[model samples]
Target: MNLPNKLTLMRVLLIPVFLVFFLIPGIPCHYLLAMIVFIAASITDALDGHLARKHNLVTNFGKFLDPLADKVLVMTALACFVDNQMIGVIPFLIIMMREFMVSGLRLVAANSGTVIAAGFWGKLKTAFTMVTIIAILVYLSFSGDFNSFSLACADTIDRVCGWILTGLVWISAGLTVISGWIYLRGYWKFIDPEA
Candidate 1:
């Protein structure tokens, strides 16, 4: 395998490690560790693509596995967030469906000897969604029991955090929907029998 493909596989390998950190409650600073692992995996995703494109090492395997790795990592992280009540189910569903649909379409295109690379909208959607997830993780990592604070102060901070999370979720959801539509619409010929 090429370097880029190796990097992509490394990302897939890291997911279970991140999961262990995220799901294990007794581990000290587990959320922070999870965030760090997640960020590392995200870095690998970017690095692999850059290396593949720059060195003319892009292959069918890389094209197929890279996006799959991305979806697996991001979706797993989002699922972790949902389980912890850091995000709502509706927004998660929206994002998850987009990933799955795009992935499915990509697979179909690949089978037809076409490579459906990511567009601007899809890249932006990924950026926003990753940032939102990371931000939520950071917040949850450092947060303390609000009950220990003065009620008024706790209420104020709670409202502020709520607004931040809500804003992030909505913005990410919007990007997800727009990107998903653009991808499917752009490649309708491959997706639609009548096209």
Candidate 2:
């Protein structure tokens, strides 16, 4: 396998490692370790694509697995957040709903010998989602230290983090809905039974 495909596979391999760090109890700085692993895996997502196009190493497997890896990594993080109460159940279901819808759309398109690639809005959603996940992880990782600050400072910090984290989550959720709409609209013909 070429380096690009290797990188893609490596990213898939790293997901479990990232989760291991994120989920394991009582590890020192495990959240930080998870973030590092996640960020590294995220980097490979871009690098593999860049190298694939530059070196003409793109393959069907890469095309399929690249996005799958991204979704798996992101959804895993979101699931972890939901488990930890960093995010609400409704938002979690919203994200998962969009993912399922898109996956269904893709399966339909594939059955019809068509490939519905990720669009700009989808990419935007992914970028925002990754950033949101990282921010939440950072916030949750150090939230315990909020008690160390003075009352005013703690309140200020809490307010700021709350606004940032909440805004990121909503923005990412909005983008998810938009991107899903775009995908469905763009490929509606594939989904139309009479056409």
Candidate 3:
């Protein structure tokens, strides 16, 4: 109910609006619209955390919901990309696998009365993932233009974007895997094989 928590909720609320803009057909500049919505949500993601720490408004609810909102927002975009064939399935699967591993590790830590904060690598992965999504949306927005020049170089642009996006996906996936491993290893003692 605090400002930071409200911002987190706002980020979550914007996800459906992003989907509406992203998934619906025939909307003028739909990709651009979705990108704007996504960017707005991303800003809130940053703002909430900053405000939470700056003003000492951090709460258990904020801690729980902020990361959950981030994961949901990111995974939803990745799912849309895969469903639309904008990206390959492997990167999506890899990111999702990392999320599952991290979430399970968090559960183990929580049960042991320990809280695991996001590490540097995890933050880097999230930042890179958001930037990649924005880049792809920017590409899509321009690609939808049917200007003569664009039409003439459509294949070339598509090919270039394809390679760039793939590289971005793999880079993000690599970070996710590294961060997941770090989190798991750091808290391995909390996870008991006997349990």
Candidate 4:
């Protein structure tokens, strides 16, 4: 496999490691570890793309799998966080639904001989979503009754983080919907009009 593909596979592999850190009980530094792993995986996502484009190493397989890998990582993290009650159900559902809708649109565009690359808004949405998730995870990691820290301070921080996450989620959702609509409109003629 090429370097970019290798990096993509590495990212996919990190998902389980991220889960292990995020889900394991009684681990003193679970949240910290999870955040580190998540950040590392995110970095790989960027590195692979840069390398692919810089070195002319982009492959059909890389194009197909890179975004899939990102979706899987983000979705899995969001699902796990929701299951653990670290994040709310509504945001999780919105993110999940957007992913599915976009994936469907991508498939339709692919069949029509159009490669719908990730646009600026889509990239911004992903970056903001990742930042929000990371912030939430960090808050969760530190907010428990693990020490003698001021409860009020922790609560305030938690609330701030929650608001930030919620705002980012909504913003990302809006961008996702807009981008998906734009893509669908671009490819509307490709759809089987008779069907």
All-Cα superposition RMSD per candidate: 2.2, 2.0, 1.6, 2.1
lDDT of 1 by residue, 1-195 (tens): 999999999999999999999899788888889889999999999999999999999997887788889999999998988898888989999999998898889889878988888899999999888899888777777663213434668777777987998899889999999999999989888979876
Global CA lDDT computed for model 1:
0.88
- Model 4 residue pairs with clashes: none
Give the poorly placed runs of model 4, Cα more than 4 Å off.
145-149, 192-195
For model 4, residues 143-189, the per-residue Cα lDDT tens digits are: 64244345768667667777877777677667767766776676666
Question: For residues 1-81, what per-residue lDDT tens digits would candidate 2 score against the true structure?
Answer: 889889999999999998899888577778878888988999999899999999999898987888888889999999998
Encode model 3's per-residue lDDT on 1-195: one tens digit a residue. 899999999999999999998998688878889999999999999999999999999999998899999999999999989989988999899999999888888877888788889989999999999999998888777776333236777788789889999899889999988998888888888875865
Model 2: clashing residue pairs? Answer: none
lDDT of 4: 0.82
Worst-scoring 10-residue span by lDDT in model 4:
141-150
The lDDT for every candidate, in the order shown, is: 0.88, 0.86, 0.90, 0.82
Candidate achieving higher TM-score, 3 or 4: 3
Runs in model 3 lying further than 4 Å from the true structure? 145-149
TM-score of each: 0.92, 0.91, 0.95, 0.89
